[model samples]
Target: MTYLPLPQPRTTPVRVMTIAGSDSGGGAGIQADMRTFALLGVHGLVAVTAVTVQNSMGVKGFHEIPLDVIAGQIDAVASDIGVQAAKTGMLASSAIIDTVAGAWRQQGLAGAVPLVVDPVCASMHGDPLLHPSALNSLKEQLFPLATVVTPNLDEVRLIVDVEVVDDASQRDAARALHALGPQWVLVKGGHLRTSSRAPDLLFDGTEFREFDAPRIDTGHDHGAGDTLAAAVASALAHGYTVPDAVAFGKRWVTECLRAAYPLGQGHGPVSALFRLNE
Candidate 1:
């Protein structure tokens, strides 16, 4: 029997892994993460934590992957293909969080790989993604292991009990989240009316730097969060420093937002299709 020919050698040295739920709508989750990774020039690997059923309307339901299966996927990739960086989204439960955290520690990837933890709490439509009981596990188990924790205003309130209203409060909120032990915490000000531009605060336990973009007046930005976190992961995989990675992410997601499009009955998704232009 004839065997298939071996593929050519890879020129890409950077591999970024996304540990996330599947979005059937293709607007967010792993779908969005993959798009961001590819556009940013990295090989994307996945460890699906859950499968979500939803559209622009909202998340109707979701089925989490089995604990062992989730852990196995992570191990499978780490031991063989090997990722340079990893990011997480939509960890469905406390048990899943513990399992993923355990796998990270066991693989000695906790402080090794640059881990971008997007503490996804709710959807843009205000639907819950993580279970209430999982919050503590996320903070206690995952945050300490993260290179950065990117929390939007809503997640900032949920995770650290700080309501970000203005610039000073945004700074305060970033400080509160830093205490949880991530090397850096990015407090997203996308939803905050603190300024005319979309301002985001990055805190490295001590210093605070703000990154902002021209706030494109639009409502069709469903995948913005996933895109930002994924872009950061991609940058990290390509050897950018944490601050520089985040800076690249901010610029990338801003372009994505500018290209946002309408989808269904509710809000649509941001676009990375803009990269086609560049």
Candidate 2:
């Protein structure tokens, strides 16, 4: 006898928005953030700030989106579609950074919703991704609004002027960044050459916590930072606390890094495709 099939209820995922640049390479920026969000069981939204012309090799150039449009995108999503958590990346100018920060305040997501700020100023290959004039604006206008700011060693140097030569210095850098007013700051140690096993340091106003992803020895780690930040935002949307979310993010990006593969003439992107099965 043939049994009749019953329909199951359609489910909606928690939404996590990425306010960043559009990577034509499909490796980093908005592409990486969205890919990471979806792989982690969350709905992905975007408010693209720039259109970058680049590939695995490096960023060639980028064009910023209009200020009004950038803010409108955030407002549109926050008003009707809704966002559970959000992130910022590759805001190439002071004006754009200010626009994004103001949009978050207007939408009431500045402190109310978890925001992961990835202070992306350059590519791994040393290609500039941010304008020289915008650095001060990023630190002043955006950092305070973040729930967690994830900065790699280079960004650590750029942000706090502390060269993280060792674990102790990593703590110092996190302490410095925490003073910038983010609720928490994660100092990523992936670029540390002094140690074989690089660990990340998280500092709140009170104490410190550490997270270490199993090091995957691969150069095709183009989107690792974006992936980590996006994963943190996704976990936040799932109602995880800041520390737990960062822990989950570190674990997730480690897997992505492990599965990274070359795509072009240069470094490829860290892949969340592996998580599709998990």
Candidate 3:
């Protein structure tokens, strides 16, 4: 009998986790994160905090997952599979935020796992994803623990209570958010109507760097924020520095947006698998 060589142990891929909601439309939240992780060659794990009924048109409704269950999911993944980095999105309420924060501390993941926080306050279609009452808790409990916080203009306005109407105000917003204790703050300026270039500012308390990409004239960027944050976390899991990871994420998101395709009626999702075709 021919003896086959014993199968060698498979090398484990870099692992990342996303603590976020579930988009039934599969455009954002856990679905988008998983897709971005896969595209970046990382093993994706998830702890879903909410399940949203949404489509391209808008968010119809949502239901938050139980606090214990959310904690259990994190514990199971971190204790066994092991997470190198993680990202949070669409944490609907203060209870969910507190639970996630407690899990991060109790699991001893603080300072060990790089966390990218996407303060998802509203949907792309202008529907509220987070409760207004939960905003303070999210800032107080989760922002300090974040390695980096990615917030769009609207989210920045909500967090810093400032009007980000122009580039100057956008920079101010970035600084304000950086003051909240995140090691870095990325204020997405895609909504700035005054500029032709889509510029995002990164503030690390002492320095400010801008990443500019040509603005794509398209309405298919429904999951762009989720995609960018997940890609950054995946890069972090692969040992990239925070700045480098954000740069890579920006390029990746730009490409995804460039290759976006129409799906549902209103707005479609950026193509997370765009690289595959290249």
User: What would the per-residue lDDT of candidate 3 be over residues 61-165, giving only the tens digit for each residue?
Assistant: 999999999999999999998999999999999999999999999999988899999999999888998999999998899999999999998888888997888
For residue 162, what is the lDDT in candidate 1? 87
Candidate that scores best on lDDT: 1
Q: Please, what are the lDDT tens digits per residue for candidate 2 over residues 117-160?
A: 99999988898888889989999999999999999999889888
Clash pairs for candidate 1: none
On the 0 to 100 scale, the lDDT of residue 207 in model 3 is 87
Q: Candidate 3 deviates by what RMSD?
A: 5.5
Alpha carbon deviation, residue 242, candidate 2 (Å): 0.7
RMSD of each: 5.5, 4.8, 5.5
Q: Which segments of model 3 are wrong by more than 4 Å?
A: 1-9
Q: What is the lDDT of candidate 3?
A: 0.89
Residue pairs in steric clash, candidate 3? none
